[model samples]
Target: MLAPTTVPMPGLPERVRIYEVGPRDGLQNEAAVVPVAVKAELVTRLVGAGLRTVEVTSFVRPDLVPQLADAEELWAGLARSPGVRYPVLVPNVRGLDRALAAGVEEIAVFGSATESFAQRNLGRSVEESLTMFAPVVATAREHGVPVRAYLSMCFGDPWEGEVPPERVADVAARLMALGCTELSLGDTIGVATAGHVQALLDALAEVGLGVERLAVHFHDTYGQALANTLAALQRGITTVDAAAGGLGGCPFARSASGNLATEDLVWFLHGLGIDTGVDLPALVATSTWLAAHLGRPSPSRAVRALAHQPSPS
Candidate 1:
């Protein structure tokens, strides 16, 4: 088991890259459609909070994900920040076409680590999905849009009992070979443990895949996201995907919860002396705003605790 307290031997970067996915991933699963103007404002707020990489929205079919039906409008409407990189998810060639038309700079493609999940979620076998993505990735490269591939269900799958470590490593290697500049491994249902995280990392290393190009996306469904994230950090994995207000859940997967809250992750990083460049107080306020907009309480424990404390006057 990889204990969170097991610090890296030495020479790891002190700061980490936090890819904020609240505006996109977090809001997509909401029951009510957040207005496009509100979405743009949310992105602006995240940028002001010092997030350098924010996933604005996806260029998916409106019929598929009605929440992101205004993808093009959202992308065109947002106040673009010079420093932040906004990446949108593109499922296939048609999705890539929409993204290209919207002037998207960076695009993300997703595939599952298990064949069953891939078939169910993507309507294709794992190998077939990769084949389908080859042209999409190639086309994106030609257009000078960097691609980041997401390997879902890296830890566990609802259909499959336990996904093997080798399976996750194999899919990640394939995505990297397919010209994905970076790969984000997702614990889609948030059922992963610290030991499972280390085992997967060791397996990936065995296949010559370095941790630098890897990112971890964990859900707080089982209250293990932060601990798993720490395990990844201890293994030299620096990039992490978090959602503001801890908003988001898989529509297809039942009983799934939100991704690791950005506020919570920021708190963890701050305690470790790692600088994320995000304003903790401002982020807490943003989380509060989002929760109020959704008519729910803040899902982030850190944000909730901070909300109750007396503010510095």
Candidate 2:
């Protein structure tokens, strides 16, 4: 029998919450039309694997993201478990209105640290897009629903090469001040390295933003998600966002790959004795299920490995 595991680093969070974005961010980029029933079932399986925070779907306009057009249907059919939080992405006041009407308990807003990306993705400057969300954040806070702000292209932008760490921190600080309870710094193009991740966190610290109120969202375009996650963890970050089966990529970011695979992140965290509360075998099974629906193999190495793992008698 193998010996019990111990964390190599001290002062790390005993338990890290795996922010599962499979049902939302993962499927958002799928060209195939995913049924509401399938989306609901995916969320159920993820929660069964002990995922506390699952992004169920997005409230983006149907014309913009037809993949999640059945957001209301999915939410209605979702299995509700005590203590599990199902948050959805809401891009504007209209999205927020629909989410609130559906009884959403938490919501996420998207933005960018770079002006060029902001203009291209959201059709406004970084500052202008931010100003538009002030009322949305305030209204959400009024109803006691927690808000998570996402800053895309935190590390690198396709149009803007090498985003400054301080610029990333500035946008993050602004989001926090806008009544967002937490900020999810997104490596949208997935060009971040371990050193860049560390430097960004350090810059946030310098601006009085503690790791407790921050999360990291990474992609595996260059296969740096796991390494970047470790760097963020070492800096006291407790929340990380990932997509099951490595599904989804940024449509606005050119030549980008899928988001970091939840299975890969789980394997790394469990090996470090960092509790993510995710059952690896079950999580992998969920990914496999979705892969069949997508008619493609999961891009996650851990999912592929676990699917082929021999069952013990």
Candidate 3:
């Protein structure tokens, strides 16, 4: 496992938090439901590799996302790692109830920045979905739970072309208004480029949402996820969302592809001397093992290269 040369970037954060979404977002879109034990192992391996924040599973309707139907079972049986945060996605109050029952410490709500995605994903208009999340956020807050808001389709929509930055900002502000401590801007369709990434961050700043409250989630559909991420990092964003082995896509959006690979992200960050506290070889090996379970090769370039690298003479 060869490492990248360190060329420290100017004006970058000393440390970047990689929000590992492999367990939840990565598995949700799988055609086959992974066993609860395997899911638990994945989280255990990721935590072992130094991902402090891992989204373990989603509390969505079981029938809707059968792949994560064992969320409760998995969470109950998962080995808790000290100093690590395990967050779950709760769609509405019912989902929040299940999460609360499992003693979830952190929760994230999914919202759409466009009406088309709102209807398609959440079965409601943008405002109606927000109305639905209101009680969920309120209840979680009452339980002393911190909320994270995921805003999908922030850049472009497959059905609706080019979403406006101002529109995204408005929806993001409303979601944050619901008491979400962090907001992750999602490039759901993977149509966003580096310029689009900065523009949206600028728009959010205009609406008083600073980079401190922001994280970025990008898909590699157009091979832009890493570049878009770099642009966001340049804008002072310290949190990034990535999935191991580049495992998942939007179940609702047919064009959506796998997320930014955690391995690839780590390689790029390490090259620039940014600390992610992740062990490169351990992370690659984890993705490699998980890929074997899925019966496919990993989509991450770094994983493929590192996992198959020749031993040094």
Tell me, by TM-score, which candidate is best: 3
Error of 2 at 55 (Å): 0.3
Superposition-based RMSD of candidate 1 using all C-alpha atoms, in angstroms:
3.7
List residue ranges in candidate 1 displaced over 4 A. Answer: 1-12
lDDT score at residue 98, model 2, on the 0-100 scale: 97
Look at candidate 1 and give me any clashing residue pairs: none
Per-residue alpha-carbon lDDT of candidate 2 for residues 1-313, written as tens digits (9 for 90 to 100): 1112555567667888989988888888888899888888998999998899999998988988889899988888888999999999999999999999999999999999999999988999999998989989999999999999999989988887999999989988888899999999999988999999999999999998999999999999999999999899989999999998899887677667899999988888887888887888888888998899999899999888778887755
The sequence of per-residue lDDT tens digits that candidate 3 reaches over residues 1-313 is 7999999979888899999999999999888778899999999999999999999999998899999899889999999988999999999999999999999999999999999999999999999999999999998999999999999999999988999999999999999998999999999989999998999999999999999999999999999998998899999999999999898999999999999999999999999999999999999999999999999999999999999897677
All predictions: root-mean-square deviation over Cα? Answer: 3.7, 1.8, 0.7
Ranking by TM-score: 3, 2, 1
How far residue 240's Cα lies from its native spot in candidate 3, in Å, is: 0.4
Whole-structure CA lDDT of model 2? 0.89
Candidate 3 TM-score, true structure as reference: 0.99
Window of ten residues with lowest summed lDDT in model 1: 1-10
The TM-score between candidate 2 and the true structure equals 0.96
Better of 1 and 2 by lDDT: 2
